[model samples]
Target: MNICRPYLAKLCSTLSGGPVVSGCRWVSNGPRFPFHSVKDIKNWDLDSDHQILPPPSTIFAPSKGRRTRHDNFLDFKRIRVTAGGGGDGSIAFSHSAVQPFGPPCGGNGGRGGNVYIMACKDITSLNGILNNYTAANGTMGSSNNMHGANGEDMVIRVPVGTLVRQVQAPIYASSTAAELGDDEGGVEAVGQDETENADEDEIDVEEQNEIYAEQMMRLLEKHFKFKTNYRPREDRARWLMERLPPKPYVPPPVLLDLTVHGEKHLIARGGRGGQGNPHFVTHEIKGPAICERGEKKEPVWLEFELKSIADAGLVGLPNAGKSTLLAAISNAHPKIAPYPFTTLNPYIGTIDYSDFWTMTLADIPGLVEGAHLNYGLGHQFLKHVERTKVLVYVVDLAGKEPWRDFEILQAELEAYKTGLTARPTLVVANKADLPRARSNMEEFQTKVQYPIVPISAKERRNITHLTGALRSIVEKAGAQG
Candidate 1:
């Protein structure tokens, strides 16, 4: 406990408190102790009220009577993308000073720039800058057998929660929805009789409409004729709904922008350069230099949108050991210390249940009093939790009253969004290493009538038990579904 005081102090110093500042001195000499730059922590303000932090639409909500920005402002909405094309090879001849007899020389083209979306645990907020993004291909080669410089590649940065989808590939009920438009247009034109006595024009219009309709019908037959459907009407509707474009991943019932983060989609990309004529002027042949061809252009449209952040979200009051548990259970390496509200964003970790079943867990930022009303850091981090299927509430058993902690958290969740309480939940008690934790754990069990497991994440105690229990619960839900 003496050794831990300094670490605890450092955590408090990072937070907005006096006690934590005093505790940090002991940790200064410890090997595992961390000293973070104040700059890194500037983005986070523990004292800020998040729940009432301006209702995602109010432009500014008062924090201690001062106006503040919307909670979702930190959430990114835009991400631009660009790809590089191959560089053109230069065509030149090597002429000796004496003989001056060299075959045509053409360098090979530089390979096209490859693009990738690397998975990261932190660094979300892609949706914030998705707008105004662009990518370009590599340049063509020069004349003196020098290959043209390759175009610079543009990588589309996105949060870990983002999934890439092609631009608006609408799957129709069937390709041939009965050739409704062409025939209907002709019928309407003929019926209107706007062109009086113009029978020839009407006949031409009729023939043209029939041809257009036939072409459309043929295209549909060619593309969708082989498709098969096995689902019910409701399932079909659901599938369509799934395919339907999302209405921008906004905080539910918030005033985030519809124009910038809305239905916009990428339409086209820059074309690749044509080949230079150096391969045709071969020595064996008459002209190997002229035989080479330029690369073909690849113009494609791409669309990306933010999806739900994670499947399971870990939430609760401050100092609940959310970060410790996250680091212990998965590869995620969130900062952990004996303090509240250590995490700012929703940290993600992948929990592999089996070869076939793997689910992601989100360590949502800690909640405090009046979080939903934007009372603290809770409001800023609450949106990330909205998409989770399961909510795990971590309670500090040793620090304070466990049942009161639970009640406070319940109130915070309800205040933020009413539906959050309805999600599947598990109440967990942390810090079992402390002597006083057991009695508090038992009391919580009796009062809540739900199974409560006590654990010490820092000590690595009961970690396996906690993980096994979580797996059982998650898998059971899957089975029932």
Candidate 2:
């Protein structure tokens, strides 16, 4: 009888739904068999010579795709986050019999909100950006010296391993076309004087260049200060100066781009609001009471990135009890089932040790053969493996030729990414409870080249051995690094 064939049906159930329960039967003197998930009650073959099979283990993924697969759990490419603009000061007027010309009724404007980047690892994608509030313009300053309200804040979350780059708006050299146009217009007005003014235009261009250079230098000095002894006051002053547009060459605008995994989000921040009328006071309206105008909002861009850090990955074909092992070892409770592919997604678990020590384990989806070629949902499963230092290849030992199964899995890994197979790998032969299991273990040891540890995820046998082995590998990798 094909030993691994009975478990295949159960694998389908696990992938789609939950665990399957099946009767277990073992025969002495025959090949040692472990758990299985066989459905038909009448097919049990309860004769004197027959044994029953356990329900099938769950499977993950319809299988196919090695190349890919992030934030709000919503995928967005870009979003505009506009910080509230500063309110403009108001100009108030007050005239009394005793005291004329009321003090300038102008009040300081409110500062705009500053964007920030916070790091979080649990976030896998940026899908949350779609549901977030769009940018809001700053409130205009009120009359009688009231500053305008600051804008509300917008916080964005991105997955780990993201890289944030400030994308600057393209710098356009002020075109000489303006001067040419002015010359042409002047020629239409005065043809003979046009040539003479050409020299004057050249002189004006040079003067403008000098002014631009000076303005740029002043802007830089006001905004950027790097010295051995830097004071906070000067730093704040510099910050304020930098936000103010440069005198001539508007400092090239900056656009923030956040790249998470392979996805990129360009254009993150929002626009600034217009200023109030308080600064427009003149000598003619000299009063003691009437106040100033409102403030303007500022829009800026920002980026978000994600970084994933894990020490080990518990990987295997679907229904190999990867999630069960994770649940047994860590606080994570991944869906468990009897059929194949029970887990559709990856679940992260933390393993705690003595003295406040701990490590992380990522239980990724199952990968069949040809995962590297993106066959059988392999690509999405493979990426999570990239960050892990060690790979725990979990295998169900009761199935037919578990050792051959291990080899096929290794081939798939090597095919998908060349260096993957070379990484430190541990072979875990699971389901060691049945009568025929011992013989299968012996056969596996003789056939396989790497170290193989036997355990039963259902019976909780030899789990400590696996944990110790994993910890040792993790510690060794750390020390080596």
Best by lDDT: 2
Which stretches of model 2 miss by more than 4 angstroms?
A: 1-80, 85-104, 107-109, 121-130, 135-137, 142-146, 157-308, 354-356, 414-418, 434-443, 446-448
Residue 304 lDDT (model 1): 45
Q: Across residues 17-97, which tens digit of lDDT does each residue of candidate 1 receive?
A: 233333244323322323445443333333353211112223233355432232233453323343455555454566789
Candidate 1 is scored at a TM of 0.44
Clashes of 2: 82
lDDT for 467 in candidate 1 is 75
What is the per-residue lDDT of model 2 for residues 1-481, given as tens digits with 9 covering 90 to 100?
4446455444433332433445423223433334444444334433353333333332122445332331123222443344444444443444578867555544444444434443345565665544223434445444455666665555555665544544422233124333334311221234334435566555565565544444443443332322334332444433334445422223344433333333433233333333333343346433322222222222333343322347888878888888888988888877788988777667778998766678988887888877888877677677667777888888888877788788888887777677887777788888877766777898888888877888888788898888888888889888887
